[model samples]
Target: MKALFISLCLSLLMILSSCEGRTGYLDEGQQNTVAMLTDVEWLVVYVDYSISNEQTFDDETNIYSFGRDTKGWTATGSLKDPSIKKDVRYFQWTFTTENYAVIYMAGNSTDGYWMIEKLTPDELWVVITASDPVLYPNQYKTYYKLKARKRQ
Candidate 1:
């Protein structure tokens, strides 16, 4: 009887300890860390996210500003020129290193969001998703992005 009781206790302890070791955890703090576009990287106009059906805009420019101490970042992307858009000047995207961001567009009908898909010292992929289409009100927008390595 003594041997049986001792064996039972040992087995229970092993089982509990093994279970504890198998649990998994997720840390949101390190999910999609990306470089701020305003401060670190220069904005290159390769793809435009603001071209709606009814708008006619012109040559645009953008600048970035990081939060006081990496708490977040803000982007002011503007639309100038009267050919592509009208009554539109600029938009702002506010973000954090947490990998998520929000862009408040300048035009009357433009607004959206974004996030970092991946980031590295050499290469990066920032995915941007937006809503409020000129023609398709029900459909949202999405942009998968890649950033080249900065020159030394």
Candidate 2:
């Protein structure tokens, strides 16, 4: 009886030790993504619209700040173009449980879901898609891509 109880205790201890650093919710990759996102301000470097074939290369002044509280702000403007007025917009964002690569954003200017194509310490690329001919004129589906780089 003593030997059986000692074996059971050892097994329980091993099981608990295995879960020591586990968050039980977010995996390591997801935690890393969250860390990278809230690390610094990101500057918009490129924008592309699929239906219109419109591409805009930003002057690296359009900034995006993601906070740990899941709130963020975007400062839109061009450093090279004096005619472009600077605009600040606030938004709430969260990753979907079904797919962490997808982010849902709701704000005054941004209201949609965006899929992350690439994410690194210094670069991020995301795409938003809308599929409605009536709403999105020229094409059955419209895709908008935004590329950003971390601000120094």
Candidate 3:
């Protein structure tokens, strides 16, 4: 029994040591991307997916705002759905190599994982692969394109 316990401990130690840690700084290009994304509040100009249709944000009627901070982000807007209430939430964002993910920071249940497709000062594009609860059994590879809101 003692020998078996020792073997188990050794095995656990090996497994733990093999796991990678999330400790790294963004490269120069990645830093630039992050800077641009955080520079201004973004309007959701287009969202195309199996779960949701494409939408354009106008000054009146339809409006969506998404922004990122140093450590977290916030988004608040309406989906133009009568049945669904307006969405407003805060989340923590982490950026990796050409990818980023958001985790709900306020106990809200929305999370997102996206791969960066195009990143520019004026335009930001990302691809999201997910499965919707409403459209279960069907996966969606969605594309979201957003343009920076004009600063007045």
Q: All models: lDDT?
A: 0.39, 0.67, 0.55
Error of 2 at 111 (Å): 0.8
Worst 10 residues of 1 by lDDT: 79-88
Candidate 3 ranges beyond 4 A from true positions: 1-23, 60-70, 77-87, 98-109, 131-139, 150-152
In order, what is each prediction's RMSD in angstroms? 9.6, 6.1, 9.2
Residues 1-152 of candidate 3 have per-residue lDDT tens digits of 99999999999999999986544656676667667777765556677875657765553222223345544434454334322324555555555334443212222443655556787888877665443322342456677786665432
**Which wins on TM-score, candidate 2 or candidate 3?**
2
Is candidate 1 or 3 superior in TM-score? Answer: 3
Compare the candidates by lDDT and give the number of the best one.
2
Stretches of candidate 1 off by over 4 Å are 1-44, 48-60, 63-70, 77-118, 130-139, 144-152
Best by TM-score: 2
If the candidates were sorted by their lDDT against the true structure, best first, what order would they fall in? 2, 3, 1
Would you list the clashing residue pairs of candidate 3? none
Q: Please, what are the lDDT tens digits per residue for candidate 2 over residues 1-152?
A: 99999999999999988885755477878888888788867666666655557555646356677787889877766545534435889999888643477777788787666667788887777666442222443543333333444344
Give the C-alpha miss distance for residue 70 in model 3, angstroms. Answer: 5.1
Steric clash pairs (candidate 1): 38-64, 56-84, 56-85, 57-84, 57-85, 58-81, 130-141
In model 2, the Cα lDDT at residue 33 comes to 88
Report the C-alpha lDDT of model 1 over 38-150, residue by residue, as the tens digit: 33432323343445423222345332233323333223344332123223233444443322433333232334544454445433344345642332335444443333323
TM for every model, in the order presented, reads 0.33, 0.63, 0.54
